[model samples]
Target: MRDDEDLPFVAALYASVRAEELAATGLPEAQQRAFLDQQHRAQHAHYRAHYPTAEWLILEIGGTPIGRLYLDEWKREFRVVDISLVAASRGQGIGGAVLADIIAAAKAAGKGVSIHVEKHNPARRLYERLGFVLAEDKGVYDLMEWDMARPSDQGASEP
Candidate 1:
């Protein structure tokens, strides 16, 4: 988000998200860390290339970095490239607040907001509760979307 100045924080954030999965592999600690570093670099490059204009943002609370958000605003849809928070920051309503803002902005622009969420991820419930309907199932992930036309109290600030 802050460019090179944020690389370390971004890498740490990526490592936090993969800690459980990497730990399950039972690999050596050093090897796991190296793997995560490589994967983070690869993902960073991929996103930059694929979504050249996407906004990379750092989510902070009280001046402490808690998460990262990547979004791409297109003519017809606002795409949520990624959103992740540290384990300690989960369930604190931060994600909901950010998502609500995106929904409201999308509604005001007459566009839809879309995100791809893992099928088993707990965040899917939050998206559903916020009026995002399952639009497609892509094996392990599902494409969810919310439009201004949907009848719901969500994105209430729209209009």
Candidate 2:
């Protein structure tokens, strides 16, 4: 976990799922390296962007941070702008369970919940099952949202 290479499992997950699409539009090897270098700096610079004004949660198993879910209100809905699990730890129901919990919480808060899933992401099925529909499609990713609770069953964000 010390070196970025330790994220091979995570990288592999992304690669195996979309290597062809990525290679077709992404940079060459050296340029990709430079891009990653720039991304490292940008991630640090925009750390706060990872957590918006809405409720955010860290997905952890046994106290280890495996992933994150950021929620922010927009147009009366709570949007999950980002979510990523360690490659080794994905597909074990963590993402789905966390998603369900977040949706439940959003319902109680009188806010709808949404997230963007890549076109080829395996998690897309989970979202669909959870009642998310295509709110928008940005070519690479789809904006999915759900308004589960009726007005009578909802209120405001919990303090």
Candidate 3:
């Protein structure tokens, strides 16, 4: 989980995720970087204020920072607030491993695991493959959920 010292890395991770999208704006490099930095700080503050008790985790590989995972375990469900990886870290199965762990923990506690995924996000496929089904559609995003109590062959084992 993150502590005060991890904020810089967390902000960098956030900026990395938006690099491509911000680039598309045709803004100057300096401006784009500044905008991303400001946005990242605001987002960090928003998450802290809203999900005060959420676990803020930094995903590292060989001591190198690669991604971030934020989770909130409520009385009835385990909510995945956010999970993001740098471009170099994507498609490496790290996310699946982390999510599998979360699933196992949720199962042990008899709680469902849920995440809100953006409408066209690639991660949606990963969620579906891991047994998360659409619970609701919030226009821009869809609420996906996996209940441990449900009977299925997709039980948490691997992947």
Clashes of 2: 0
Scored by CA lDDT, what does every candidate get? 0.87, 0.63, 0.85
Task: Sort by lDDT, best first.
Answer: 1, 3, 2
10 residues in a row with least lDDT, candidate 3: 150-159
lDDT of 2 at 40: 45
Query: What clash pairs does model 2 have?
Result: none
| lDDT for predicted candidate 1 compared with the true structure | 0.87
Residues 1-159 of candidate 3 have per-residue lDDT tens digits of 545698888878888888988899999999999999999888888888989999888888899989989999999899999999988888878788788888888988989999999888888777887889999999989999988756235533333
TM-scores, all candidates, are: 0.90, 0.65, 0.88
lDDT of 2 by residue, 109-155 (tens): 77888887788877777777777778898898888887764222222
Measured by TM-score, the strongest candidate is 1
Backbone clashes in model 3, listed as residue pairs: none
RMSD of each: 3.4, 7.4, 2.4
